[model samples]
Target: MDALPIAPYIPQHVKELLNVSIKLIRFQYIDYSGILRCRVLTASFCLEQDQNVKFVGTGPAALYASYVEGTDTTPVAAACRLVPDWSSFRVCTYAARHASVMCRIYETLNSFGFRRCPRTCLYKVLEIAEKELRCTFLGGYEIEVVFMDVTKSPPTPFKNVVEWSLMEGLRGRPIEILEQIAESLEAANISVQQLHTEGSQGLFEITTGPLRLMEATDALVYTHETIKTICDKHGLVATCFPKPSAAKGLVGQHLHLSISSLENDPIEARTVDAYIAGILSHLRAICAFTLPSHDSYTRVQDRRGTNGTWVTWGTEFRDVPLRKIESTHWEIRCMDGTANVYLAVAALIAAGIDGIRSGRKLSWGDSQKSPSLMTDSAREELGIKTRLPLSLKEALGAIKTDLTLSSTMSQSLVEKYIKIKTEEAESLEKMSPEERTELGIKYF
Candidate 1:
């Protein structure tokens, strides 16, 4: 186990406490399908080893290609190594007798970074942002999940009232589940800024405080796992599926972002404007990563207020795709729970960096009316030229043609991502809507 560069920042007292308290260490990573996977080793194993690196088969990466369903010829079919990032080390509050940490994947013999690794991809983009743009990105995710009654034949929403932030909605099991989730997240050092019921029955949202790019996304992954684990222990099913049903409203994983200089000052207006312009310019292509599933498109429709269909932005308008919260921050609404948070954030950073470099200007003004409600002539007058891609196939096609976004991601990763998602889209085309929803809940 190779020690992380963050070891220097760990206080000696905290280090000693961890060394004494932890019995097992879990090295976790998110797969291409956005599922959290882990490999566990005894604490003594890490303490005894000079370098904390652990070797594991790369079969997990092949999971996106359905390697388990059939044969896998992907590069990830070989052996690889997990290099622990000590900065991400967290004491597991949900599970006793173990601690968890995230790892960067590297090829065993060649010592090359795995191209398809989401964490590494994010780090590369962040590095470019800091080095070239001279800025630091801070972000947090607003996670929305539904609690289901598993005892029913088909799981149903746990609450009957379909109200937003209503106390009546949280009267029973929902409140207890949410309280436990908040406690568990706080215990793991992941702060929950707010937790409340959403518009959909049994749907709740958790808002977390901001952190640097990598830490924010990594914390979200841990947060989701904690919610699901605790919910299961209480005999309820917690799902972040974007649209659990057509009758119910949509659920989203909205990303809130802000940028600041190395000196910790808020970015200038010109720089901030260009950064947003860049994102809006490449949003359709970026959607290939942020909204990865066929069902994801189902949630990103017009008039939903959850996510808009057009590529426009506004000041605190929920109907627009990008809602400007403050001079320094904006909320990206197109993303859903199914997205791989690391890849999604990386794509946004890549787009923003390009925008900054190119000095892009905002081509359109803010619109208070939802694009879906606006007349064609109104949209034309505002310079809103295109609507967002309506399907997974269309979104993938947009990425294929997007030179700017394609250049930002590694060619190998983009190719593999398209291949895996294309296959998924094709497969979904043959399934019934109910079948598709069931499968999405199981994996996403």
Candidate 2:
């Protein structure tokens, strides 16, 4: 078994944590399937005097656990260690006497981070952006979830449906649940920019204020966990599945991102241009991570506010996937809650850095109108030369062919990821839309 030392990972404020009556410590990590997995230890166990007593063991396959029912997707027979990043520690507001800390996966006690660890991939890319490119990123997610009363036969919406942003959506029990969620997040120091009803039955959207890349992802995970925990406590289910119902229209976890110089100076115009260009250039391949699930592709239809199929960008345009808000800020409309956010964000930054390094230019013109509304010649004149991969299989294929993007994320990890996802796509392809939707609601 791999051993993770407790001393180095423990925070200086251990006494403060104990004073809060925190009894259980959860070492959490996001698996390849975007599911949050954890191992719990009693707070007393962490105070052991014997050095040999301070370790937690995990199987390597935990990183490759399938979305179907948490089964191992790979046959790797080895132990893995969970090294807690003490910085991510926060009191579990939803669970009394509990705390959570994000972890980094290691193959052995002495080894560096595991190659296939999604968190590790994100850290490496972030470091490259800061140290090499002299840039740092800030981002936040617009989370959309559909609440259901699972106790009902076939399940039904937990609240009476209302129009988008209507105050009635937050009335009664719904408001109570959201208030508790907001309070929990605030206790953890995660800012809530806004919370409102979405344009779908039983769907609600929570937008968080921007933070540094890693912090933003961790907050998103925590926020998701908080929402589910609160809903479960009230006998409801919250599913982040995009296109949860084929007829209910699409809902996604859209990511808004911005970049600034590492020293906090104004970002260079060329750097911004190349970064956006880089993302647009590699948009097709990046979809493998952003719009990951089989159901995710169903949300990519044209003229449905799902972000159009075209590989381009426009200023505040909902039809295009990449919507530029300013020279430094852009909103990526393709991502969903099914994505492993760390890996998704890493892929985006890496691709953008690749463009910055290569000094690529943003050649595509700003699409003022949806391409679907434009004539063929009109789109051609605007340089909308490519389209997003239309299916999970096609997206996987795109990632495989984009050697630069794959190599940057580590070729071995990419191959393993592709293998796991290829299996998922094949398995999902055999099922009907209803079955797929049911499976999605069950897990995601």
Candidate 3:
């Protein structure tokens, strides 16, 4: 029962996790202020849920257990179930508990009458997508986040950031952080395709192997927790916000996705193109969730695509809503680390599936490098309309227009998220940027 403070878990389940791994307590969610965050689990974090459970987030319903004896004081990391050839996972979690329990929960749920997709927004999005396209959708996702040397003895507003240097950005000893991240990701079965430094200061990315809907969601949460811990140990802060800092805060999580059929064939050309169209059509609305923060709009642009401009395909057009990485796959650029990963990715999946089902027109354009690379007149003429919402409230209103999308985004969750965000925006409005700056992660 969800009682005051979630009570202590049933002794049996706690014992089971402890027996398997006792060196650690369960995974708890804490925000930048070191407050225990909430974990919203649709079901229990029972070990048996391995086959039945789908994914977990910071609501506090589930956590990993490890038996390393005296490792209580040690820092822990998160690992995903990535396949091989991506990153080595063992050294990755020198401090992490075994993820076997997580898989067990998933496997057990499947054995029972549970759907591979859980009863959550991400699942609903996947479900709607499959139903619409009348086909299966495989998910291949990757995101980027930035880290800084912010101390936590007592947190402070993040005013300092390392400007990304193409020459020395990740070229120095700092690159070791990327190596550790890759190893930890691999340990959890998550694979890393590559790691890179971004154009912004201290911005970095860790690409992961492809996974289905639920599993992909799990990986995203785990990645954040893992990296955050590591960053903390280094006396730094890892921020996934659309833009954590205004001086040079263009932080975003670019999602690279690939969809396939029940059969092995991929959604190429026509369907894929149409899928892009559907995504673009629904993009402004989707940003209501992706750019969920009041400051989220500040991080978007078409020039570099930070302004959340057009939904056009271009060559590394960071500002474009959707940039074609190749003929088979493309990455959406507007999403930020601050947006709920599950909500944003699920919106994309649903919107694209809608595109496929609607048999909409597929629109493609020159993949420019950044917003500056493309002229406004040319972008408009190409039918690549600009629809990035400037504020969180504006984006939420845009998302509200799509009744069908509301189906994908649970009204309950949206209500809570929007209510909190609206207050935040108003609060930020009351304070000068400097005042808001002193309080770290006000939106997050």
Q: Of the candidates shown, which would achieve the greatest TM-score relative to the real structure?
A: 2
| Candidate 1, run of 10 with poorest lDDT | 1-10
Best by lDDT: 2
Model 3 lDDT tens row, 1-444: 011111222245544544565334333231211122332222234333334432332211121221111212233332222111111112226354432222211212112211111224566667666655555554545566666555542333233234543546776544777787778778767778877766666777677777775666567666776778776677667766554555454666667676666556665578777877888788878886677655567766645535345556665555567767776567777776656566677677777777777788966567555544557776665666665677777776777677655555555445544554555556556666545444434324
**lDDT (tens digit, per residue) of candidate 2 on 187-284:** 88999988888777788888899999899999999999999999999888899988676446576999999999987578889899999999989999
lDDT for model 2: 0.83
Which candidate, 2 or 3, would have the higher lDDT against the true structure?
Answer: 2
Looking at model 2, which ten-residue stretch has the lowest summed lDDT? Answer: 1-10
- Model 2: number of backbone collisions: 0
How high a TM-score does candidate 2 get? 0.94
Error of 1 at 228 (Å): 0.5
> How many clashes show up per model?
5, 0, 62
Q: Which stretches of candidate 1 lie over 4 Å from their true place?
A: 1-19, 49-57, 60-77, 108-112
In model 2, the Cα lDDT at residue 106 comes to 76
In the predicted model 1, the residue pairs found to clash are: 1-51, 1-52, 1-53, 2-52, 2-53
Instruction: Tell me the lDDT of candidate 3.
Output: 0.55
TM-score for all models, in order of appearance: 0.92, 0.94, 0.71
